[model samples]
Target: MPPRSDSDNVGFLVADVTRLLRAEMDRRITAAGLELNPGDARTLSHAARCGSVRQNLLAERIGVEAMTVSSSLDRLEVLGLIERQADSVDRRAKLVHVTQAGEAMLESMQPLAAGLGAEAAKGIAPADWQRFLDTLKHVRANLTAARDQLRKENAAA
Candidate 1:
């Protein structure tokens, strides 16, 4: 078989879309002269959405490296966007929460994010759009399960 094109592969297509979305978000933040970059915005957004989540869990949910999330959180904390408190159950781990300032910032960014989503789905009908989103969520759940199983198998080996 001839070598496959990157645009024709599921993994490559997903990565391309993700890169485009993030790049647009980065551009909007920079254009707005926001103090935080895309990385910090994402970290803060996740914290606000998840509500007092463990750092590792937030990193896992965001699909980023632990150090990447940690670095973002550090910058966000300095900017008063997020705060890390000692986890009550896990002594070694910290729980991250978005501050009021973070929420305000997120409120300001929400319109931009919604606009991006709308732009991404511009030509799609409402029914198809919801179905597509549902499909993506299902695919994500399956992939997460597969990843967890792989990790368990690797640990056992």
Candidate 2:
């Protein structure tokens, strides 16, 4: 297939939306005293979701280095938001788990995320909203595939 023209391509739109969301999230998190960077927030959220995730797997899922994940986990542990425990299955490896504080923080961030979504959807029609969501999912899938392809190419190179 032919490549899309710059204007026709959805990349710019996706990038802009991502940028805006990050900024809004940063603002809200700062206000809420989470004091976390985007990467930290994402890591914490992942830990919260997985209950207990392998360190390497969490890093792979986040598309970051294991070292970065380790550092973030250290900071989170210090903050009493997360803990690392020996993996039950593989006694040699450690798994990440969110503490009660982390759960509370995640819960607190929900309303802020909802408010941001509501604000973005303001004045949009119902049909348009559905289409918007569909387009977003499509974009997400496309980007995920691209990321996986890039990782493969990088490994080969």
Report RMSD (Å) for each prediction in the order shown.
2.3, 4.6
Off by over 4 Å in 2: 1-8, 35-38, 138-157
Off by over 4 Å in 1: 151-157
Candidate 1: 10-residue stretch with minimal lDDT = 3-12
Please, what are the lDDT tens digits per residue for candidate 2 over residues 115-145?
9888888999979998999987997899999
Leading candidate by lDDT: 1
How do the residues 1-157 of candidate 1 rate in per-residue lDDT, one tens digit apiece?
Answer: 9986777588988899999999998888778778888778888888888999999999998999999999999999998888899998988999998889999999889888998999999999999999999999999999989999999999999
**In order, how many clashes per candidate?**
0, 0
**What's the lDDT for all of these models?**
0.90, 0.85
Q: Please state the error at residue 17 of candidate 2 in Å.
A: 1.4
